[model samples]
Target: MRALLLTAVAVAVALPVIPAQTWSTTACGPAAVSVGDYRQYEGTGSGTTPFSFTVTVTTAPGCTATGSVAYATEHISTGPADITATSGTLTWTDSTDAKLVVVGVVRDGTPEPEEAFSLRLHTPQNLVITRDRGRGQIIDDDLPPVETGLDGGKICWRYESSAVEVGVHTNTPARAPITVHYRTVHTGSNPPGYYPVKDGIITIPTGSTRGTATIRLKTEPNLPDEQFYVEIFSPSAGTLGLSRVPITVKSKR
Candidate 1:
């Protein structure tokens, strides 16, 4: 009986081991999607210029993602005057992951305050949006120089020793020294000679909004109420306002 039991155990051990039926399932589905952030962009110079911004869509590894995304401008806030409009669209594909949109900016030939607007992403087909909105800034690069008539529009000089101040104004602060070329025109009063016009250029220090040019009148006894002109011209930057200035020298009684 013992020998028979041992033989049975040996037979059972010798039998080949059968592996459990293994089942594997393959994963099939759409890829995970996400959108990148769009930052601010700026444009310079005058006239119509093309400006563009980009939007990015990221897909999970090994993802066979396919869908379409749309972009448009929203919450557009223009300055006091209408400057320009923003417009564009973006689409997603397996081959391309990023897309760019171009917008038009109308740069008027005048100095104005900064303007701003925003862009929005919506109607995403199969992608997740990490950031849906981005802010855009349109910087005003138009800097113009305007000449303000003499401080008081006119200055009366009683004597040659008396001097009058003429001013030039700018719409924006000067980034660098601004020089204005000027000359004197004797419109009235002869003889005794006109006041010596020494400096032809008025240098406006950096960051200053205004600069002045001085003209001294010549003291004459019987000169028919002399009048002289201080004409401003050729500014380093921007346009000139009231280029010509008039000064009256009241004749001595």
Candidate 2:
């Protein structure tokens, strides 16, 4: 009889494997979008005609989107028409990124503070909007020797017209914002009561030639024609030129 030694066999126990934490689902994908901020010079008249700035859009590593995303811009200090296009789209893929090119006009004017605008992301198309609101800053380039003056030299306001746009101009664009002190002067030819006493400051922005002020006129259908002069005095920056401007108020028809 073979010596059947009762050898105790040690059996290995298999442990159950645990899976990873599922952060994403089929419906709620892992794709996300990011928008980048940018800053550039406002450009000059002699430099480039149409200056441009860029904003970058990046897709997440796990992005699986195939189409594009749309975006819109809001003018903070600049006007709607000042920037080339208000709304645009960025095309992207699972592995690619997109960029937005903002083109602007290089207006020659005084050097002033930096101007800014805003950009927003829209229409994610099922993707996540991780980051939005791209801030854009436009730096002024015009330097010193910027001469300031009055614009709309002579203007006529009809009785039907409630207000008129008057402005102060500069010979050259400055590097900083300018405050022009102006007052309505009532002379022998022009009397009071036709219009209210107007005295204020008009701020001319950087890289801009003119800053405007709206003057409200009194409607006098039966009164005679009236005239008054707008004179711009001490300016915050740069010397004043062509300070006086005449405004004539015509009687009602």
TM-score of each: 0.40, 0.41
TM-score of 2: 0.41
Query: Which RMSD does model 2 reach against the true structure?
Result: 18.7
Q: How much is the lDDT of residue 10 in candidate 2?
A: 97
Over 31-81, each residue of candidate 2 has an lDDT whose tens digit, in order, gives: 566677766545544323233334344444544555566778777887664
User: Local distance difference test, per candidate?
Assistant: 0.58, 0.64
- The best candidate by lDDT is 2
Error of model 1, residue 75, in angstroms: 4.0
Identify the candidate with maximal TM-score: 2
Model 1 — TM-score against the truth?
Answer: 0.40
